[model samples]
Target: MIDSHEELGAELAEKVAAAGDLEALKASGAFDELMEQIDAGRLQIDGKDGFLNLMIKAVLERGLQTELSEHLGYEKGDPAARLLPNSRNGSYPKTVASTVGDVGLAIPRDRAGTFTPQLVPRGSRRTGGLDDMIISLYAGGMTIRDIEHHLESTIGTELSRETISKITDDVLEEVMAWQSRPLDPIYPILYLDAIVVKIRDGHQVKNKAAHIAVGVDLDGVKRVLGIWIQASEGAKFWAGVCAELANRGVKDVLIACCDGLTGFPEAIQATWANTTVQTCVVHLVRASMRFVAYGDRKKVAACLRNIYTAPTIEAALTAREEFAAGEWGQKYPAALKTWENAWERFIPFLAFPPALRKVIYTTNAIESLNYQLRKIIKNRGHFPNDQAAVKLLWLAICNIEDKRARERQKTRTTDKESSGNHLVEGAATAGWIQALGVLSITYPERLEPYLS
Candidate 1:
């Protein structure tokens, strides 16, 4: 086996080489010397012996001092120094203990002293009681009682429910700040939708709508723009939400895909006049399928698929008319009517390039976001209020944001193609603009500015 001095010298050499500049070299040398002293058993505490204990004590003391200085802005000679007063009159006491393996240095402390030691004791390397338990419990994802039992059994410490609640409650303010954060000015594509949750309003539990806005930005990375918990999902509420986004610097959105909620299209138009609203084709198909009999579901779905998958609007329309003339059409006129009513809005997607078509044709992107949200909220049967639901959903969205960031990074590393350029080409085409015009009449207020 290599001698201890050789190992220490190798470590010192590696650290010295890694040092960047003059100041870093000095710091590295100091740390290396400290390590050397401990390894040689040259440091002693109260007549106790070993190099390992002294190293641990030194590390703990330095860590506590750094935390206090950075977090509390405490400087040397400051009055706040008394809070974690030095053990040996501003010097650290070295107490040696047999239980501490390796380097032996025991730290001495005054029992009656006002200094509440934040570090591994003034001399001991054992961790503090409450703080360590709190960190462990949080890392384990244990509920309050489980955390309490864990601490009480493992460490023989009494942890109360109220204290645990207070600790977890700190996340509430963070959630609020995150929910209201500013968003980028232009998102090439946006997905908007709402998920319902049961929440207690006063004494009774009621359903509340949690509206979400997710977008693909200029860099092609998905981001959550904002989340709001409202009493209900309505045009008026969405109008206010749109206004809030505008105020927070969302200047433009090229296209917004959403479920067919009444007034949502109008709400989006009120904020961004040029924005195109793509009704969720999947939601439309599902709603239409609900009206068909079990035996007829497959046939009905086939006919609907024909309309959407057709190569052109003219071809889709011809197929729709032919299907309406068929026997199944006579039996399920309402399903056909649903498609007819939405046909004008639906066909505009065909005029765009395949890439743009894939994104605007459905609300599937937002649906995936909703699926993740449901997984998170599923365990909680109900919440205290709308704000509580909002907080949970916001936390869930933050989790998703991290996942999407990783996905975008990978996508950027692999794909270098641009999206949305063809969308402008389709926008300026006379035939495509005319096709959009037919649906505009049904949505006059929303389409007027774009038509002009």
Candidate 2:
């Protein structure tokens, strides 16, 4: 409420919110300020105002009173209150929508009833809460009727289907704006993958692929760059997706760790010639396992591990030769064949230290994101259109990003390091930093510009 979520003002909310609860807030020397506000004929709090609800309600009521004061050219307790031709007409009951729930507002009045308040004007059903509630439920993949019923059941307030749809449509503008927003010049690493879901296309139901891009910044923090909905996963559509990312200002991508999508590497190179393509080694390993018998899958995986775990590409090739010559490799010939075919792209990460190799060898960033996206839309029957698919996935992305941010905060200097690595401290991203250090040494020229 201080200002629209602004430039570097993300930190503003936390600073403003540091006031704690009413008791602790009052104890923070706000009592004097509260008294001053009361003297101005504004700022009232009831015992029921648990957190900011009282403050929010008081803010609305206080705004109406001030508007009335301005209209009458007098203060509430001043002699002008009586001297004024029109006097205070008390207040009226009205419910204003708020994020927590609905809040009943006492709208201040003038004797002549000439004053029309602006915050919650006459015949207005919408408020902050209604809009927020609609967006929240809609983002959770709720249907319009579902949201309408939920609001009615929870808050005893009913909104029409049209009203619900209209409220949710507000996000389309935001989504478009976000999709077109300028991105950082460089993303150290990007993980690209897709999720397929059914979408209603005219009369028939068709499967559509929603390609998702997750970027890891110069720092280890991950961000989902964009979501693209297409008829299906194909190299042509993926090229267009890469083009869109380039248009959005992603000029340089150091390494793109992705699934073994045929045209994916080519699509990335179309935008960034210098970008190294690291086809996810973990993907190759998993696909290799599928070719092996279930019982011997573990045995094949153990044998194949030597190639990926080798100290250098030469060492990896040597291990590959040994695995290909081994009994397990002979039993599961297809597993070694899969590794051999993708060996060129697979060995790119092996040249670097294990720290960096661990990060770039898998598409875990977007893979994990896709897994969460699938979970959110699992109960959904089918997306109505491409836009609906985009909207739902975007909402799911927002939530997943928030959870990651919280986890980043909760990540202390005392966490365990990695699968095969130990730690200097508990910091969750210690392994990422260690990997970045290796990247700096391996590609000093490419990484120097982004290094602070």
- Top candidate when judged by TM-score against the true structure: 2
Candidate 2 — which pairs collide? 413-426, 413-427, 414-426, 415-426
For model 1, the run of ten residues with the poorest summed lDDT: 420-429
lDDT of each: 0.63, 0.74
Query: Candidate 1 has what TM-score?
Result: 0.64
TM-score of 2: 0.78
lDDT of model 2 at residue 240?
88
Error of 1 at 269 (Å): 0.8
> Alpha carbon lDDT of residue 436, candidate 2?
82
